[model samples]
Target: MSTLPLLGAAMTVAELEGLQDFILSRDRDLELQDFCELGALDADWKPAAERAKALLQGYKGRLGIHGPFWGFTIASGDVEIQKVVTRRMRQGLEICDFLGATQMVIHSPYLTWDYNNLDNHPGRKAYQNFLDYTHATLDPVIAYAEKIGVTMVVENIMDKDPDIRRILVEDFNTKALAVSIDTGHAHYAHGSTGAPPVDYFVRRAGNSLQHIHLQDADGYADRHWNIGEGNISWAAVFRALGELTSNPRLILELRNKSGILPSVDWLKARGLAE
Candidate 1:
């Protein structure tokens, strides 16, 4: 019997209520998104975490969480800011531990501007500085992740150079770290920023790509539209994914949470996903 690929949705705690059966029917991967807000995590997270457990009862699937990403960058050069980012990310790890999640999505620090200018400084020192700051921020988190058996998948945001995140993950040289690609973000970069196409991002990341945010976009903003709603080449992207040895969690990250299953059906209809 052929094993089906890991496929699922990124949903908040409340969104799981109406979609639990649909999700469990698929019985694959899931990414909890409620813990990404710093204020909410600080105010109180136990209630939501408990509710998530209740809602996810009988769900036997790979679980992950979207870590804190608002109002801060993980690669902030400021020492104080780096400390705060580290703390918030640790809290995210706490949630992962509490929920037994084995994966957490962390946004990449690579920016579009850094692609051409990272070499501007003498001997590529600017890129080295970015790496230094990023490492300082993530090392602690990666250590805890390794201890708890979680893989920190760094997601690409405004990353124009696909090799950058892949190289960073390789530099970490730990199973605790991997790559994540957001199709909409890649498409936006391809059309709007002259970067390579979405499939190229998948191909570049190669086996290091452990998690993927599948969505559609008009090659403009991060629309996060449902699959087939925009212009992404689903067939080509899935073809590239089919070549990967890594069994990545293909999670549909749509703006409208209601579109999760419909998008799955869309992919299924096109024979791109099961």
Candidate 2:
């Protein structure tokens, strides 16, 4: 029999009562990847952990957790800022343990204000500084992840190119340190610049892609619209996945602001579902 094709939804259940809705609606075999909302380094993460555990109790499908997004950076050049970000992310990791989440997604740091002074924005030294700091800081986190039995997957930014992404992957060589290829980010990275086509990233990352943040993108901003709401050629993407030796976990990374379920149904009607 063919391996059961798996699909995941990015939903955070930060309350015990929400499990009923999540389980009733979600597919029994499908994964549920949480988009944790612990944005700051405040001491409000205890409730987040409680909620994740309650919702995931006896959950039949796989579990993955997205680390906090707002005001957190793992690649900061400033040691104090990096320490705060690390503390915040460690809370998310603790939540992963509670929910039995095996995968966690994280973002790299942006440039410091000093970058504004550079003649070439995103200059070699600036990028090198970011990379140097990221590699050093993340080493401890990687060790912590292994100790806790979770793989931390780094995501692609909307402005990065395949070359930079290659460095991101090659610089931190490990199966646990994989890519979270965001579709909208791919369009943004390639649409404005004359970079290689988006698929170049997919093929280059190859088997190292642990998860995908699937969404359609207009020529401009990341619409986060459902499958065909924009111009993204998702059919081609699935076709490419079919050719791969193994497929990464396809996570529908759309906003949950109503209408998303319907759009998912629309994608299902178009044969995007397994």
Q: Model 2 reaches what TM-score against the true structure?
A: 0.79
Query: Which residue runs of candidate 2 sit more than 4 Å off their true CA positions?
Result: 1-4, 14-41, 110-128, 194-197, 257-260
Clashing pairs in 2: none
The whole-model C-alpha lDDT of candidate 1 against the native structure comes to 0.89
lDDT of 1 by residue, 134-203 (tens): 8999898888989999998999999999899998889889999999999999999999999999999999
lDDT of 1 at 136: 92
Off by over 4 Å in 1: 1-6
lDDT of 2 by residue, 81-197 (tens): 777766666776776676677778887453323324433655477667767777766775776777777777777764355545456666877655777678877776567544445
Cα error, residue 216 of model 2, in Å, equals 2.0
User: Candidate 2 — what's its lDDT?
Assistant: 0.63
Model 1, residue 138: C-alpha shift (Å): 1.2
